[model samples]
Target: MSKKHKSEHHEEHADESWLIPYADLLTLLLALFIVLFAMSTTDSKKFEEMSKAFNIAFNSGSGVLDNTTIVTTGEQMSKERENNRQPSKEDLTKEQLQAAMKQEQEDLEKLKKQIDNYIKTAGLTTQLETKLNQSQLMITISDNALFPSGSAQIKPEARSLALTIATMLNKYPGYEIVVSGHTDNEPISTAEFESNWDLSSSRAIRFMDILLSSKKLDPKLFSAIGYGEYRPVDSNANALGRSKNRRVEVSIIRKFTDPDKSQNIPATPK
Candidate 1:
């Protein structure tokens, strides 16, 4: 009986039998993970094949990186460079034209003095006023000096102003010339003109005609405009303002200098 008890104790102390199946399950799980890891490390062709196969089997899109398509580094960089390109041909041309126009404005200061000197020497300072602006050398003549109060016919004395102006303008044949007419806010009614617009335009045309008929000037380089009472240099609320507004302006188209100019040179007549 004691020997039978010892056998039973030995059998009870033996390693538990459940360890066999538990070890087998662990081995199978480890093998499965290893296989999956191996599959994930495939080349492009194999990866595509697997992706398509999975998508078909699962009834879904390709099962790789969601919806992203991987691209080479060079290809990505080339695409980025293309997208960052600037200024089309037309845009560049427009920019160049605008730059040229702005350059012309810088040279107008000197041109004004030339006009002023002509005014002083020709004894036209009182009748033809000198004004310097960013883009024009305006020689303004009062209506009383150029014409009667309500007429476009220029006075005989006004010919001196036009003749000297034509001489100066002839020196710079490339400069564009504009004769513009301005007026006060007061209404006008005449046989030749019904409103300020007609009067202003007629005056501009008359002045342009005088300049064109000059033997020294180039008619091709001139034009005329009529800004009736709108573009005033000052408010039209007082007598001085009204008188200022009622004048004719002859503008010499400005020229450009170097972009780096720090000071103005004297207005030299060519």
Candidate 2:
């Protein structure tokens, strides 16, 4: 009887051994649920990347999906549309060029009126000419009007010119001012300048200092450079051309946007 009872007890426990496989099935089902929950919560952009990687791992040539996941498409068909997207390298370079030109355009018109009025009032229009172009607003001051030959010093009368420009600049708050000095190709050897290069650069720096000296402006927004007859407005062949080239150029930093504000790079293009 004791042997038989022991045998029956052993048989009952033998059927219970299937619990191990049952527990394993439950574990696998729980893991599947967790994975599905994680997939549901992932970010769309990151999910797109992950999907692509998985597809590649599976050795599928076709991409995960066609334009199903993306950020934007760049197109500028109108002006009112806010271009608040990140621009591509080509788009960015082109935007910089366009902004530079457009910014110059508005500046030219305003500068024209202001300069014409000043010239008319102060009787210095012919001697001090304002020129407008695609990239710069140039106020040309004859040596007789602004400085002595080879000297960076601004004449007393030239103070009005600086003040007027500064006032105009104050009206437009977000522009960088670039003052560039150009010199005639003729060699300049003097105490003031080791060569035309020095003279040109010094003249640019000196004039820029006059602008930053204004308490209203920030020093960070101004730049000075010397072109030393390289970017002459006309041929070095004549006195008139050289005179035009020998003047100072004041450039207003144009606005529209930088690449950070206007460009959007999408991952699918790659």
Candidate 3:
């Protein structure tokens, strides 16, 4: 009877070890829900603290969630993507303008070199000069090189030189060309020209006409201006300085310029 009673008590309390592991599973599931709830909130500092505690409880600091990036909402992800997107149209246009300006500068430099080489080869260095600046490329020719003393007409021999210049200029089209004439302060009253202004104006017009003779050169892009004795490059008190003042300038104006560099250049009178 005593042995029978002991066997029944053992059967009644059989396999209680399974309940220990079941309780541990329930506790792990509850911890997982708590971690999920914390992540759903915007309190990052608390989430980090909770993550650390969980690491210590489950993985001893080395865990799958270690070094995890903070969870972000859909809108936040979209905003981040927009911030890292490609350049805008305005940015592309600015880059294109910079590239175009660089190309134009190179073209102008090459044209200047070619003209300089021609002047050297022709032994006309004293009568001709080329200068490239921020605004334009100026080719200056002495008045004596193209005309008789106090005359508006270009010499027959100078026609060939003008033709060559026109040929060179034809290689670079679509640029605004200004043919400006300047004279000494010496007063002039001739049968054909009433004043220095008349002479200078006629001279500029005649030279520009020759430049326009080239079919390849656009007449619409050319202009003639005469400053008379006003825009002298040197003092008019001496004969040599007066001679230097009598000249014609062919200026090829730039279409585009770098704003930063253009600001440093002094404004030259037209």
Candidate 4:
């Protein structure tokens, strides 16, 4: 009877082996909680090392925290996005330059229209002409309008015209202005002038001086050039053509131009 009681007691202490795995599961849960707490306070490098150690001890590098990335600040994320999307410095400068060129072109067109209207209203179309080219807005005045034959002196009546032009020019500043003189092939040897070169040069200087008389016009921005019989628009063989060839030109030079467009006038004439 005692032996029968011992066998029953042994049977009553049944399935104690299952506690081993249950304890292991609880241990793993505790370890996972610990890993989460450490990750919250630690940097990415140390967290990665700890994660690796835990993974090796538990699941051979395939643990729950295997692919987690470090959290970043809002500023860092914004900077990354900006780096991906922002234009380069060169591209920004090119866009700005293109816009400036476009604005310059528009301003030149407006100025040309104003000068043209003035010329028409003053009945000076035959003696004055305005042309808008890629390089400049050129105002051409016949020599007979500004000067007498064989003379570099400006006509007294033309002083008012020059003053009006200078007033109009004062509307736009910081532009380089060139007053160029052209002459026919007629030879001139006067007391005040030596050759066509001297006559043309003096005429240009005289007209430029009138323009500079306006205090608003910058003297440094103005220049005078004389193309004596070398750059003629008409033939010296005829009276009308020679009259047309003798002229003075005022050019408001462009500060900016489109690179893709063709230049209508030489920027610097040889």
Model 1, TM vs. native: 0.54
lDDT of each: 0.69, 0.65, 0.81, 0.80
Worst 10 residues of 4 by lDDT: 65-74
Off by over 4 Å in 1: 1-111, 255-270
| lDDT, residue 161, candidate 1 | 72
* Model 2 ranges with Cα > 4 A deviation: 1-108, 257-270
- Deviation (Å) of 157 in candidate 3: 1.6
lDDT score, candidate 2, position 260: 46
- Candidate 4: list runs displaced more than 4 Å: 1-92, 263-270
Q: Every model's Cα RMSD, please?
A: 21.3, 15.1, 22.5, 21.7
Candidates in descending TM-score order: 3, 4, 1, 2
Tens-digit lDDT track for model 2 on 189-259? 88768898888888888778777777788778888998886878777888887776788877764444335
Give the per-residue Cα lDDT of candidate 1 at 241.
87
lDDT of 4 by residue, 1-270 (tens): 999999998898768899876765765665576568557843465566556555653664243334332123324444665787744325557678667667777777778888889899999999999988888899999999999888888899999989989989998887999999999998988788889999898999999999999999999999999999999897889999999999999999988766576854232222
TM-score of candidate 2 to 2 decimals? 0.54
